[model samples]
Target: MPDQSPSSRRFRADSCFVTGGALLALLVVGGLFWAKYNMSTVKEWRGGNAWNLTYEAAAVSGDPRAAAVRYRHNPDSFRKDFRDERLGAIRLPWHTEANVNTGAVARMEVAPAGEGQVSCRILLDGVRVVAEGRSPAPGEPAVCEVTTSSTPEKWPTKPS
Candidate 1:
């Protein structure tokens, strides 16, 4: 009922276009922010889901010998019936790491090749020590094992 001029109609159309553009831009920015937040959360979750199995051995004497290392890398490791792996004339003060499935049990046993000490440990996210064992005596075997939780909240953690 007011001024029905072409200029007035153009003004209304331009106002609508500007409002719509602003809304679209706001939506795009909001979506991007949401995606970025979720991506970081995903990365954090992935970081928390890791498990590591560690083996170590050392000797007082500089004798060259290979330790017979037996270990259960995972609960289902035997399903493949895979060939046994050898550390192959390991170096003194030797250590190794292996990835393990969450909530699975891991075990490691090492016989000292020659002289000093052998140790094995399990860690959650490489930060929390779940279990560890050291050689009982010189030239003896040591065993370490742990049962992990499927979720981080359920882990039984101790100082590393």
Candidate 2:
């Protein structure tokens, strides 16, 4: 080319550096936004996985009431109690958060169903019927396995 001054060459190099830097920064910012937008989808996936694992464990254990209690205390405990290595790999940020509580128990009524059994009706969270079974009259107790249809939508959006 014609005579190009040293200052002009340096300016060109600087402009190239600045443009590359801006592009890189823009990509990083875009990635962060993408991750934020998909966070709910990720949580939804995790919740579904957890619920399925819990349901399997409860079904096998044949104790819905105990399962419900355990879920209340620690939702992630099922993965551990059942030795689910797959689920253990995915850690949830809100593992200790309670999804259901005593206040969620809308109603619980027990009455005699027969000589040795009592009818039980337990409602939870004004929506789910946690338990309904004919339990033993006194000594022996019936098992009521309660599960939630709760998805990530039910989970707290903000950190607790």
Candidate 3:
């Protein structure tokens, strides 16, 4: 075998350095992707586990008998529209809206099950009904039983 010169050895060393650098970059990028996914796991779980509904505002028509409920997802733009430090402004995954008539009893029932479950219920009479839906697992939409007999004359058309 012939003796190798110094230049040949230097060339081999440079090739190893470049290859190592490329491998290091790949590892860093992969790690970042993994971390990002882990951090967003909560969001993904909530997205699939909350109840959502859209109903007419009771104040609009002042008719308690005219109410509807269903499952729906929270609006993506709601957080930006309102700011409340107490709620952590996290913009929950589900919510409800309804129109209530005068002299009506609006009641909400919520039972949540799972890790880190979030439960919320709200009632509004003769005006508006808004509620939050959050839980640890996917389930049925929270129920709000409204009770009112015969419409009242000159119903107050304001929600406070």
The candidate, 2 or 3, that scores higher on TM-score is 2
Write model 2 residue lDDT over 66-111, tens digit each, in one string: 2121223223422422221112211111122233321121122222
- Give me the candidate number with maximum lDDT: 1
Cα lDDT listed for each candidate: 0.63, 0.37, 0.38
lDDT of candidate 1? 0.63
Q: Using Cα atoms with residue i matched to residue i, what is each candidate's TM-score against the true structure?
A: 0.52, 0.36, 0.28
> For model 1, how does the per-residue alpha-carbon lDDT over 56-87 read when each residue is reduced to its tens digit?
54454435343677665532422322223455
Candidate 2: give the clashing pairs.
Answer: 64-144, 64-145, 65-144, 104-125
TM-score ranking, high to low? 1, 2, 3
User: Where does candidate 3 stray beyond 4 Å?
Assistant: 41-160
Clashing residue pairs found in predicted model 3: 52-71, 52-72, 53-72, 57-99, 58-99, 58-100, 64-101
Candidates 1 and 3, the one with greater lDDT? 1
| Model 1: pairs clashing at backbone N, Cα or C within 3 Å | none
Clashes (backbone N, CA, C under 3 Å), per candidate, total: 0, 4, 7
